[model samples]
Target: MSYELRDHTADVAVEATADTLAALFAAVAEGLTAASAQSVPATPGDRFEVEVAAESREALLFDYLDRLIYERDVRLVLPADHRCTVAEPSETDRTDESDDPDAWRLAASARGVPLDAVAAREIKAVTYSEMALERRGDGWRAYVVFDV
Candidate 1:
């Protein structure tokens, strides 16, 4: 796994890569976690049930990252790991579910400082502007450019 910081006008963007789709998503989520908090310690808690199936892994990656970003912005709930149900892509993308996200279980007693407490790096949005999710000879890789 690898992560790099890129300059943005308003918010910081993270560029990360991994050998598997799961790993790539993990790294991407970790990027958001790092951006939102100072550090990560052991988070003890029930598993949260989150199922997001995109039309493609590329779409899946973006939705996952954006969802995490929304959590960071709204609830300050930074997920340690997303137990995603990686499914086959659908023909039409689904970005909305008329339900509450917090309805999901809190998988752990994770520690996270309030947004104001942290040295907030403004991330305007998670961008697909330069997003890429693909398969290599080894496995899968992804890239996302967050808006500042």
Candidate 2:
């Protein structure tokens, strides 16, 4: 799994590719963190978990990135070492909101150190503009734009 930062007219974009859905998410998360900091200290630090559910894959990606922003803003940390899993609810797992289209859920864990420890940039927010997520052949790719 890998991700690259691309130039944007007025922000930053990340495009990530992976052999599996979970790895793709993790790659994108790392890209987001990279966009904000020059480098993250490899030392161990506080760990946190994030969980999000959305009605579509794109929405899930948007929400996931937004949540990371919220975590950073509130906790004043730069997160790293991301690991995440994405799941689709089965028929048996459906609730009263069964009318909803196929839902996607993400559960992630990562470690963070104080933001002061890293040379950081300001990413105002994650934007829906030019956002995309899709499966290609046996692999998956995700793209996201962050407002600077």
lDDT of 2 by residue, 73-103 (tens): 9988887889999888566555676434467
Question: TM-scores across all candidates?
Answer: 0.65, 0.91
Model 1 per-residue lDDT at 26: 69
TM-score of 2: 0.91
Question: What ranges in model 2 sit over 4 Å off?
Answer: 94-102
Supply the TM-score for candidate 1: 0.65
Q: How accurate is candidate 1 locally (lDDT)?
A: 0.58
The candidate 1 region of ten consecutive residues with least summed lDDT is: 101-110
Clash list (residue pairs), candidate 2: none
